[model samples]
Target: MTKHNNLQSISVRIAVKTPAVSRALEEIVSTLDGFEQQLDEKATQTDVLVLEVGDNPAKEFETVRALLEDGVVNQVFLTSAKTTTDILLPALRTGAKQFFQQPLVFQEVQQAFVDIHKERIAGEGIAVEKVSIKPGKMVSVLGAKGGVGTTTVAVNLAVSLNRLYPEKTIALVDMNRVLGEVTVFLDLQTEFNWDELVKNISRLDPAYLAKALIQSAPGLYVMPAPNSIESGSQVSSQVMKQVLETTKNSFDFVIVDAGTQVGASAFRIFSSSDTIALITTLSLPCIINVKRLLGTMRLLGSIPMNNINIIANRFEKKSAISLEDTEKMTGHSVYSTLPNDYQKTLEAINTGKPLVDVAKNSQLVKSLNKLAESLIVKEEPVVKRKSWFW
Candidate 1:
């Protein structure tokens, strides 16, 4: 079933004075599963209110504005047949989320209501988390340049770690936004993505978050990036921080495919990460970019030199620019190197399986396993806290 199949209950009231518009609004609201139109206009509190501006729009606007400021209405949708800047500007000033100018588009109206329902469901999902928790470490995999095998490293490393510690829960999040290919790489279809999680951030707890993530392996879960470019814009660094914080508290480890993004979001990830695996290739141009990226990170001062681990991806022993040259340029020692196995790596990606899953004995998979092993810090057994009442 689709996520929007079961819409939660929402009380709607129409204050449209236009007979035709009111009937249209009523008809549309009735068709929606969870939206119930209230006949009693005297009711002060409602989940949603559709208001139409008439000859005296000023009075109606003031009433709705007051209703919003006083918390009498959660959402106010404005509709009017007359397209006037005077009406549109005031409607927006009142904090209306949507404005439908006469001859309402059916699809737009339905989509707006669906969005409201999703938000309400998300809000209601918020509750006190009663589960015991152990905070996990976050490993952010970032590419020095495009096509530097960031997702490859992240996906395989996550699978390798899950294979090593079958009991531990691992979350692989695609933070590359719309361009993310983690899901494609893993060949997993998910009902939810980062955008959905961010929308329901207030409801984030172990159970809610678990529902949003799709399990790929026995102990590995994946969260893909938003599907559309427009959806990607809705994600903010603050929301990402909250999501990551909640995720880390629930899982044993989080592997983020950050995909060469440098911005507030990237900085936030770097700041919160236990390890920042900077992926680079054994080439002149890519190494130069890596050096610049390292310099930029140092200038920002959000990431420490020790926390940043530069892993040289697609390394060849006969390459002109060796690991030593890379170290000399970046001023940071190479954390680890994965052998250049182009054919095998491409085959694994094409098959939508991690290297460990497809070719368990390959040198690339072995190197990834070693990297995962070094990242695994043995934690002491979690002790349950006794209640004061006990």
Candidate 2:
């Protein structure tokens, strides 16, 4: 009962104009338990109600005014196909918090709604959290047939974030069972492998975790694959979930360096990740593989139907295929691409250090910085940038 009164200070009412918009909003906000409500709004008193009137920017403006004029509504979100200045500007000026585009990704919407709710409650002196990523980012950096810099990108992303947010606990996981290169990349001799931890996973505790793990850098813990163990010796899917859950309690962001191979264990690990960074190139075969992987994941309930974004690694702008056709062929829009800086990426890998550590401003680093920033802030659609198709 005390918790109930305590939570009224953070109570939020989400309002939608059309049924379609209401349905879309539900896809994300349905998980929020406390005092979150979805109402067919009639311009009445409400706090932090999202007012989304799609396509009609004029109506969106009136809705915002209606919300602003009332003392009840604290924050308003306008979802429209028109995200341009002319349409989004007025809404922004009206103190609207976010401008959501059509065909909304639920993750993005979920973030915005959480932000508004937190702000509304926090303004009233109740504590609130702004953006909460689901504990860890399950980022798979699959090389496009082994030449692309997949592992390099994954390692650097993890290391860079550990450096960027030094206060927060970060983990680097090498999910490649047999020949994981993350151990080599960091120059850390393997003291323990993933197999040892999972072997005694049923008795997993803080002390057990301490013994089974290693620390090579500040604020960074590593879960390296076995030095002598093979894939068949790996822990089962149930054990994998247990390991990740325990890791989440100890770490804020878990960066997985899973190699590009669709195996039972790889699929098992990815099923628990918050974001699956599918690294591929603009080549037909790789892109086709991405399509196949996307379908396979969807079939197995591993990848969320809407969350998978195609990342074009080592992509160049002068390739045979345009980015548009690549998007069309894969049926998933490219999230962002890294420059085809083979030499720079190779140097970083050979040296066993993050590109951000050695070269902060390289084209590859610049692109990764953008990628990490987007993931940390967790705004979508993951910032689709252009590059040459390789």
At residue 146, what lDDT does model 1 achieve? 93
Mind giving the per-residue lDDT tens digits that candidate 2 earns over 297-370? Answer: 88898568565656788788899987898888878888888888777777777888778767787878888877
- Candidate 1 C-alpha error for residue 317, in Å: 0.9
Per-residue lDDT of candidate 1, residues 256-316 (tens digit): 9999998898899889999999999989888998899889999998788789899999988
TM-score of each: 0.65, 0.60
Instruction: For each candidate in turn, give its C-alpha RMSD to the true structure in angstroms.
Output: 12.6, 20.5
- lDDT score, candidate 1, position 44: 70
Residue 55's C-alpha lDDT in candidate 1? 88
Q: Which residue pairs in candidate 2 collide? A: 316-388, 317-388
Q: Which regions in candidate 2 have their CA more than 4 angstroms from the true location? A: 1-137, 229-234, 377-390
Residue 120 alpha-carbon offset, candidate 1, angstroms: 20
Query: What C-alpha lDDT do the candidate models reach, one value each?
Result: 0.81, 0.66
- Ten consecutive residues with minimal summed lDDT in candidate 2? 381-390
